[model samples]
Target: MTGERDNNGVVGVGADLDSLFAEVEALRELASDSDKARDSARVYDFGIRWGALLSGRLQRLAHYHHRGELTPHEQARYEKLRTELRDVQPLAERLGIARPTIPLEDRR
Candidate 1:
């Protein structure tokens, strides 16, 4: 759960998602600190890129789900991604960054 690889040297998707969520939270915190006046270009860039990657992955997952090819595990992953995107989108908007659009079919 700490995101370190296990004895098998394999990382779980949950760990990866946790790490990504931590990163987004860090960026959001930094961006929202009113007294710091930090340069936020890097944070914005990272958010945009991460959002794009999440959106693309969700799109593919939705396609598979629609085709009845997604496994239960994949459906769980899709829900996780969708939830993360929902959280991130609001932060992006608050930061004045362009949030990646989740397809209509993929929105919960």
Candidate 2:
């Protein structure tokens, strides 16, 4: 039998896969929250990287990964987010946000 399905009908993700989603989700939430707070509260990270890391985008990536359905464009996006987040994380923390150690991509 196939393992359990996620809400979107993705087959059961392993612990590590779940971790990947969690990391991406956290970063997305942080980015979105920071953007929302940019006008009022203090936003830590700077630049387009913040907008690039938005929840909606990351959520779509996760959904695509979940269904094991990534087009070339999406694959590029997946890699881009992972790389960009890695590149900008230190700056984000230095500027103010406390990021989690978990990475956006989980090793297979």
In order, the Cα lDDT scores of the candidates are: 0.55, 0.50
Q: Write the per-residue lDDT of candidate 1 for residues 1-108, one digit (tens) a residue.
A: 122345533234444445555656665775677643245776567667666645654444555556555456655655675676577666667666655455533536
Give stretches of model 2 more than 4 Å off: 1-54, 98-102
Task: Let me know the TM-score candidate 2 reaches against the reference structure.
Answer: 0.43
Q: Roughly what TM-score does model 1 have, to 2 decimal places?
A: 0.53
TM-score per model over all chains: 0.53, 0.43
Candidate 2 local lDDT, 46-85, one digit each (tens):
3244444344345545666666665554455556656756
Best by TM-score: 1
The window of 10 residues in a row where model 1 has the poorest summed lDDT is 1-10
Candidate 1's displacement at residue 78, Å, is: 0.9
